[model samples]
Target: MLHMTCKGKIHRARVTEANLDYVGSISIDEQLMEAASIRPFEMVQINGLRSAQTWQTYTIPAPYGSGEICVNGPPAHLFRVGDLVIILSVGFFTESDLERFQHRTVLVDEQNHLVDVKTYTRQSAHHIRGGEGK
Candidate 1:
């Protein structure tokens, strides 16, 4: 059996633009995508920190080092420039894969520059559960 699991995440990324005139999808810096192993056009889940809104969208590659994080199409109305958001992508994994699976979580500065990249593995999962007193 395959389980859907988080593949990568971009945390606290600032929105650089919101284009109501554009079609759809979130445009992210290609460098950031590469660092997180996120593919272009991959489905993503976005959580707006300030607006408290959560939505699903796909990703598009912007220029490397562009620091772009834009909300396009109708969803543009749901976000504002400078809004901090969390972007995530998920994929299916088998039981064996889960044992060694690693997910990347990227932290970015206000300008959307990469600050840190954290890898979560099965060991990290244990630590998380332990922290929760589970």
Candidate 2:
């Protein structure tokens, strides 16, 4: 059997724009996406911390170092510029994979630039390795 598990997260990312004109999906800075191991066009769940709103959309890469986190289409109304959000991506894993799996967590500054990156495993839930510059 396969289980759906969080593989990566971009925590406390600030929305830089809300483009209602765009078709759909959230656009993240390519640097931020890479830090979280999020792939282009990968489905991601976004949670707005200020409004408690949730949106599921695919990711699109923004210009590198642009600090962009744009919410597109209908969800644009739900996440306005400057709103803090958490972006999550999940992966399918076998039961055995859980034992060796590591999920990545990326922390960003107000500008949406990655400030920290950590890799954590079930064996070391409290302590994570790897930091800034990841």
Candidate 3:
């Protein structure tokens, strides 16, 4: 059987832009995307901590080290600049795959710069070495 599980998360990233005129999708810094194991055009679910809003969207890579987190299209009206939000990507995993599955966590500072990275299992968590746009 396959179980839906979280694959990666970018925690507490401060929103830096909102372009309501754009088509759709969230623009994330390349560095942040890599750290969180999120691929370009991958679907992600975002929770706006301040507005208590949840929305689904795909990702677009911004310039590396740009500290960019832009909400485009309709979501722009819900999640605005300076709002802290959580971005998550999920996948379906088999029971065996869950044994060694480690969810990638990318923690960013207020400016959206990478602060640390972690890997977590159902059992425990470990801090991995951090690099790129730190």
* Per-candidate clashes, comma-separated: 0, 0, 0
Native-referenced Cα lDDT, model 1: 0.87
Q: List the residue pairs that clash in candidate 2.
A: none
Off-target runs (Cα >4 Å) in candidate 2 are 126-134
Whole-model lDDT per candidate: 0.87, 0.91, 0.91
Model 3 has an lDDT value of: 0.91
Please, what are the lDDT tens digits per residue for candidate 2 over residues 14-119? 9999999999999999999999889999999999999999999999999998999999999998998999899999999999999999998898887988788888
lDDT (Cα, 0-100) at 125 in candidate 2: 72
Q: What RMSD, rounded to one decimal, does every model reach?
A: 3.2, 3.3, 4.3
What would the TM-score be for candidate 2 when compared with the true structure? 0.91
The alpha-carbon deviation from the true structure for residue 78 of candidate 1, after best TM-score superposition, in angstroms, is 0.7
- Model 3 root mean square deviation, Cα atoms: 4.3
The residue-level lDDT of candidate 3 at 110 comes to: 83
lDDT of 1 by residue, 14-108 (tens): 99999999989999999899988899999999999899998898899999988999999977989999898988888999999999899888888
